[model samples]
Target: MSSSQLPVRAAGNLRSDAGRNRAEIVSAARAVFTEAGTDVPTSRIARRAGVAVATLYRRFPTREALVEAAFADQHADCSRFFSVVEQHPEPWPALRTALRRFCAEQARDKGFTAHLLAACLQGRAPAGAAATSALEAERLTALVRRARDSGAMRPDVGLTELHLLVAGNAGVVAASPPDQAAAASRRFVELFLRSLEVPRRSGAGDGVR
Candidate 1:
């Protein structure tokens, strides 16, 4: 091949390799983070990806960048679920489904649960995460408002209580053994949902507060 053609081919191959390396690094990061926490070393993720630490660093300069990339798909899943909830006609059922989904996700991925709790409760978000968090918050606020308006949810229940429910479920899942976490999370979600609903009453003013 001509020298100019050779250089072009080399450049194309290099770009292809770089893309592959990035994909591997992200896949490895997700697996490692799920098994261990996000605190695991970068070198370990590099080794798991079968890539050099330098390569991983080239693709993601910071640990948070790697983490954000690793969980990107999960975040997309969340956005999609929120969109589905927004379209549901019954606000209370939609809210309950969303809560159940969140608890199930926490049971499935401890690292993600820790990351989400830290982001939602502690107001910490990596580079591209802030916008996504804001969008989700807006969607949740609308859902809560609709539920309250429909009288299915207690008037006092709001985002703060919802955040508390999430934090509480995260703790429940974390404390439970692996084999029991999912069931425990489900039970916790049901209990929280019941508490958030308007109480049934047989007499006037009996269910107030």
Candidate 2:
């Protein structure tokens, strides 16, 4: 190959290697965070990625940057989920589905649950994460309002109650064994949904109370 072409090929190979290293690092970060929480050491993550610490640092300069990159897809998925839920024609059913999915996610990934809950409740997450949580919260509040207005949800139900339900489900999942966590979360979702639903009357004279 000509000298000029050699330099171009070498640059292309470098770019390819860099991209592969970045992907591996992000993948390793996700696995480590899921297993041991996000506070696990960067050196461990680098080892898991099969890369040097300096390589990981070059790709992600800060712990927060690494965490954010690791969960970028998760945040995107969450936003998409809420957007889809918002479009469902039936407010109550959509909200129920949303709760089930949310609780299931909490059961599946401890690190993700920590990040999302911290972002939503404490506003201590990276900027993108915080923004995603805030948007989802607003979507949920709108869904609750719609459900209540349509007499599908209890009149007293609101965003606070929903947040409490999520927190309670998170607690249940955290306490249960790994094999039982999904079941526990599902049960919690069912109970919370039942409590939030408006009572049905058997006859015209029957009162909801």
Candidate whose TM-score is highest: 1
**TM-score: model 1 vs. ground truth:** 0.83
Q: List the residue pairs that clash in candidate 1.
A: none
- Report the C-alpha lDDT of model 2 over 30-85, residue by residue, as the tens digit: 99988877878899999999999999999998887898889899988988888898
Q: Report lDDT (CA) for all predictions.
A: 0.83, 0.82
Which lDDT tens digits does candidate 1 get at residues 1-209? 87766645478898999999999999999999888878899999999999999989999998878888888888898889888888999999998998788778878886776676565544556444666765666677788899999898999988789879988987898899989989998998999899999977667766654
Which stretch of 10 consecutive residues in model 1 shows the poorest summed lDDT?
Answer: 119-128
Clashes of 1: 0
Clashing pairs in 2: none
TM-score of each: 0.83, 0.81
Question: Which candidate ranks first by lDDT, i.e. highest?
Answer: 1
**Backbone atom clashes (below 3 Å) for every candidate:** 0, 0
